[model samples]
Target chain A: MAHAHESNTKRIWIVFGILSVVTIVEVILGIIKPESLMASVLGMKILNWIFIILTIVKAYYIAWSFMHLEGERGSFKWSIVLPLLILIPYLAFILLVEGNYIYDVYSESFVSWDF
Target chain B: MEATVNTQTEEENVWGGGNQPLGASYGKMMMWFFIVSDALTFSGFLVAYGFSRYKFIDSWPIADEVFTHFPFLHGVEAPMYYVALMTFILIFSSVTMVLAVDAGHQMKQKKVAWYMLFTIIGGLVFVGSQAWEWATFIRGDYGAVELRSGRILQFVDAQTGKRIALDEFAQPIEDERVVHLERNGVWYQSGEGLPSYTVNEIKAGFMANENVVGRAEKLNEDGEKIMLSREETAERLESAVHVVEGANLVRNEYGNRLFADFFFFITGFHGFHVFSGVVINVIIFFNVILGTYDRRKNYEMVEKVGLYWHFVDLVWVFVFTFFYLV
Candidate 1:
């Protein structure tokens, strides 16, 4: 209860400012869609990579600041975040790779009977 | 006798009711667990969306073109602006929610109530904006023709390089079109409502308009829809079988049908979360005004709901990036 009374309104507002700025930057980039960023880096467009990275930044702030995960004990924080970090990317990777493989098959081998 | 005393103390200190293994209250820990599971659920849906997008990588709908409408700015080609504003509203609401939790920590009843009220208002506004967005999507802008192969072909004026809606240039024709009821048709057969224009009518209208050209769903290297030449468009027009005006489970004017399905499912699910969060916030807001936490000597209830509100906002950031930005 003693620690509960401590005020961190200033910090909350700062995080909010960061989130708003990040969102605005994302929107501006989406609108402009610079040609340089349109080029593919590994497989995805550089612009898409930028958007995903910014989104992760925003998610980190929302979890750590607004949700107060930073105040939680280290073990508990990891218990929550670690599962998501490990599982989500694994799921995304498997699904996306399979989908791309299917796309290749469709383009290279699967011939439509309509022709 | 000394050993007995030590055993009693150890019993009290053991990993039972008195333990705070995670340094979190029971309810808060449970809330975090629920949030973790819920996050995985959302990720499953998003990952599925990614799979479908990759499967149709070259012909996937351009999100900017699909979600171009803005409220009160009719027929204007403002892209990403409305969704961006919605994102701002949602994030602002999240700020107010966290502020309420902070004020609750300080035991400021009035401040907590004010912030909660702001958060609830923001939630309602976000839900309303999402509804409008869904409506705009279901009731499409530029109508398209569906080829026999389930590909969409949108129209653009060749000179101006802008989309032209079906009603704008599609000529009127009278026909004896009737909805097929189960009794009138085959024993188990029924039909959905007919589109405004038939395929022959569209073909006739397209033939009459010399400047209008068909834009295929496939994107070229530059990531723009491949615009067919006039002769190619005319040749492609011969295969057109149906007019697709808006989105539904069966079809959409958007390039990929799966895109509309994922859009409806994911956003609808997220909107449902925001709706429930508002309801929870209202309950807690009332409890705050009633001074329930004041008597309880803690505002942990508010903190729990704050966690939830922030979680919703967190999910939206991903949705915005994947659905709209990327």
Candidate 2:
């Protein structure tokens, strides 16, 4: 804990560099949108998957470096991160599945919605 | 009396009932707690957006086609460029904020103030950019027609496969079109003003234009908007109910109404956060100038606010991805 008092200016700029580079890459990939990466991997386009994963990487740098979660005690870090980690994915998973089901109903049912 | 005092001290040991259990101040810990809860609130809104998007997955608006405007680039197609710039601006501000916190750690008051000023300016620019984006979205590029089924139909030049504005093709029709207001109408109900061009004029002009075709919101297997053939376009024209120029809560020139709703709610909420963050940063800025933190011999207040600013940047990362990229 006492070692945290040292200057971390170098680390901060390094993380900033990482963030900038990642953002640039994401922008480039978005603009080009290569046909090869458009294939559906697991119900989503591979390009979309790449974007989400890169976003998570950027988020990790922001929280770990900018917010200084790296210096915090292990238990403290987990206490802050665990609930969000568990809950958000659960919520997204269930809701997206339900949404897909509704789409199935809208497409398959005899009822005509687009009159 | 000594035994009782010693027992009380033992009960309130460092890891037990001590106020600073994790070596963090109460205010800082509370900020983290608040951030966790706030993160959940934002995720809830985003997840709802995702749900709606999936429900209308086939007809959801393509982000690249939508956000293609730059600040001074008129009639140029540039997608993800301006938003990338906004992201850089925000991340730079986050950098300055962390630098301010670093300077505060070394008790450098002047550097902290200057860095705080930079952070505030960056936030203002980001918010201004957001306002511009909203305006551009509301004042859409090309006009679309709303069907009786509440679907959107866009006009495209069949030869070039490019979009054509309503003014370019829609012929003027002289008629007594009046806005429905409560004072003038007998029915005590009011609605929005009339569109610039009525459906009759659109149909007439569309019939005259030999190269223009209508495109539906549905996407084909290759992820392109399904374009109707000439016969299908003429048949679909009979179902036009309204001429939609831009986006609003109720309707949008974009494919889905839910897309506009989500775009407004999520970005509006995030903008509100940035606004409040600016206000808070300003208060702390003045305090730093007054040497309040120096007098207290602790720069933790600056650090606490830095946490919040970084969190704002963090949320924007997710939003930029979900809304624009994905």
Q: lDDT per residue, candidate 2, B106-216, as tens digits?
A: 888999999999999999999999999999999998989999999999999998888899989998888648677667767866566588899998998999999989999
Interface RMSD measured for model 2: 0.8
Question: Candidate 2: what lDDT?
Answer: 0.92
Report lDDT per candidate.
Answer: 0.91, 0.92
Assign candidate 1 its CAPRI class.
medium
Off by over 4 Å in 2: A1-4, B1-18, B178-189
The residue-level lDDT of candidate 1 at B220 comes to: 95
Error of 1 at B199 (Å): 0.7
Which window of 10 residues has the lowest lDDT sum in candidate 2 chain B? Answer: B14-23
Model 1 off-target regions past 4 Å?
A1-4, A113-115, B1-12, B178-190
Residue B278: error of model 1 in Å? 0.6
For candidate 1, write residues A59-111 as lDDT tens digits.
99999999999988898999999999999999999999999998898888869
